[model samples]
Target: MNRRGFLIGLAAVPVITGAGVSVAASRYTPDYEPLLARLLALQGKTLQSSGSWNPSQIFQHLAQSVQGSLEGFPEHKAAWFSHTVGPLALQVFKAAGAMQHPLDQPIPGMAALDPALSVDYALGHLVATLQNFNEATGLQPHFAYGNLSKADYLAAHQLHIEQHLSQISVVA
Candidate 1:
C-alpha cells in the first residue's frame, strides 16, 4: 500500500516471472546437440528399433520431418484443425518445452519409408537433414502445426527426434 512497497512489488514481478519462464524452458528444452551426437556415435553399429519401423525407416522418417519443415510438408491437417487445435497443441508443447505423440505414427502424406535402407546411409541422411535445418533461413509451413517461427520449428524438431530416438537401441 505504501509507495516504497508498491515499487518493490513491481520490481519483483519480472524477476519472479522470469524465474518461472526459465524453469519451464529448462524443463522442456530439447537436447538437440547431444541427441545428434548419440545418433552419430551409433554409426556402423547394429541398431534395432523397438517400435513398428526398423532403424533405417525411423531415420528416414525423421529426416523427412526435418526436411519438410524447410521445404514444406506434402500434406496438412484440415484447415480447421491447423488453425485451431494444432496451434494450441504447439503452444502447450512450447510451454512445457517438449512434445508427446504416438511413437510409431507416420508423418501425414509422406511417401512410405524404405525398410531395406542401411542404417549408416539413413543416419547420414538424417545428419545432413539436421544440418540443413539448422542453416535454413526461411521455413515452410508445418502440416499440422501450421506456421511457426524458427525457434518453434527447432523445438518441434528436437521433440520429434527425441521421440524417435526412444525406440532405437544398439545391438552390438
Candidate 2:
C-alpha cells in the first residue's frame, strides 16, 4: 500500500480499536480509594434514609428482574450484559467516585427500604461494589447470563445500583 493508504489504515485502526478499548475500560470492577472517599463523605448520615431502598435490595431486585427478563429471552442474556450491565456499571462507578459516603456492608432491612433509603444505598453501593471488585481476587464466578471478569461483574453489580438510584430520583 502507498504511504497515504497506510496512514489512512493507521487512523482507522485507532478508531476501531479505541471503540473496543473504551468498552473494556468502561467495564466495572471495584476501585478502592475513590469509592472509600465517597463512603466517608456520608460521615454521620444514615447512608440511607426513610423512603429509600438499600444496596442489597437493589442487588436482589435487579438480579430477580434480570432473571425474569431473561426467562424467555435466553439468547439475549449476553447482549444484555454487554449493552445494559456493562455501560451502566461503568457509569455507576464514575458517579460513585464523585460521592461522599457509599455503603458496602448490608444495611439491615434494606430490602424494604423507602425511596429515600434506596437512593442513598444505591449511590453508596455504586461505589462500594466497585471497591469490592477492585479488592477482589481470582476468577469471577459465572452467572446464568455468562462469565464475567471481575471488572464486568462489578460493572453489572453497579448497573443494579444505578437502576435503583434512578428509581429513587424519579420519586424524589
Top TM-score: which candidate number? 1
The global C-alpha lDDT for each of the candidates, from Candidate 1 onward, is 0.84, 0.44
- lDDT tens readout by residue for model 2, 1-172: 9999999999999677556655655543454455356444543454332234454355444443333222322233355675655444444444443212233333222233233345445545444444444555654333333445555554444444443444332221
Candidate 1, after superposition: displacement of residue 49 in Å?
1.0
Top lDDT prediction, candidate number = 1
- What is the number of backbone collisions in each predicted candidate, taken in the order shown? 1, 22
Q: TM-scores of all models?
A: 0.79, 0.34
Model 1 agreement with the true structure over 102-171: per-residue lDDT tens digits: 8778898898889998889999999999889888999999999899878778878887787788899999
Model 1 earns a TM-score of 0.79
- Which regions of candidate 2 deviate over 4 angstroms? 1-31, 47-133, 142-145, 163-172
